[model samples]
Target: DVKVTQSSRYLVKRTGEKVFLECVQDMDHENMFWYRQDPGLGLRLIYFSYDVKMKEKGDIPEGYSVSREKKERFSLILESASTNQTSMYLCASTSGTATANTGELFFGEGSRLTVL
Candidate 1:
C-alpha cells in the first residue's frame, strides 16, 4: 500500500516567515507532487519531482520551491509566507513507469496552513 505522510497536519505562520512542509511516501514511487487547494482557484499544482534531485515547477510556483533529496521524501518551502498563501496543501505520489502507472495519485491527508 502507498502511504504518504505529512509532518504537520496544520500550521500557523506570520507574514514574511519562512515555512517548510515535509512529505514522505513509503511506496518508493518516482513521482511526487505538491498542490494547494483554494476556494475559487481549485487545486493548483505547485511543484513536482520525478526523481531524486530533479524537479519541475508546476502551474503555481511563484512563491513555492521543492527539494527532492531522497526518493521517498519531497519538501515544499515557502520563501516568505503571506496571508494570501494560506490554503490546504496536499502531497501526492505516483509510479513513474509507464507500465506500472495507472494515472492514479495516492495523496496525503493534507496540511492546512494559516498565514496571518
Candidate 2:
C-alpha cells in the first residue's frame, strides 16, 4: 500500500519563526506535494517535487518552500510562521504512472499548526 508519513501531527510556533515539516513516502512515487488545508478554503498546494533535486512552485508558494533531496523524502519549510499560516499541513504522493486512472494522491494525517 502507498503510505505517506508526516513528521508532526501538531505544531505551535511563534510569529516570524521558521518551521520545517517533513514527509516521507514508502512507495517510490515520482510526485510529492505539500499543501495547507484551511476552513472553507479547502487545500492549497504549497510546493511539489517531480523527482529528486527537482521542484516546482504550486498555487500558493509565498512564505513557503520545499526540498527533495532523496526519492522518499520531501520537506516543507515555512519562511516565517504567522497567524494566517496556522493551518493543517498535508503531504501527499503519487506514482509515476502516466495513466489517467492514477487517481488521487495519498495523504498524510496532517500537521496542525498554531501560530502565536
Candidate 2: tens digits of C-alpha lDDT, residues 1-116: 66899999999999999999999999889899999999999999989988999999999999998899999999999888889998999999998745668557999999999999
Q: Rate the local accuracy (lDDT) of all candidates.
A: 0.94, 0.92
Error of 2 at 114 (Å): 0.7
RMSD of each: 1.7, 1.4
The residue pairs that clash in candidate 1, if any, are none
Model 1, range 8-103, lDDT digits (tens) per residue? Answer: 999999999999999999998999999999999888999998899999999999988999999999999999999999999999998865555457
Once all C-alphas are superposed, what RMSD does model 2 give against the true structure?
A: 1.4
TM-score of 1: 0.93
Query: Distance from true position, residue 104, model 1, in Å?
Result: 1.0
Point out where model 2 deviates above 4 Å.
97-102
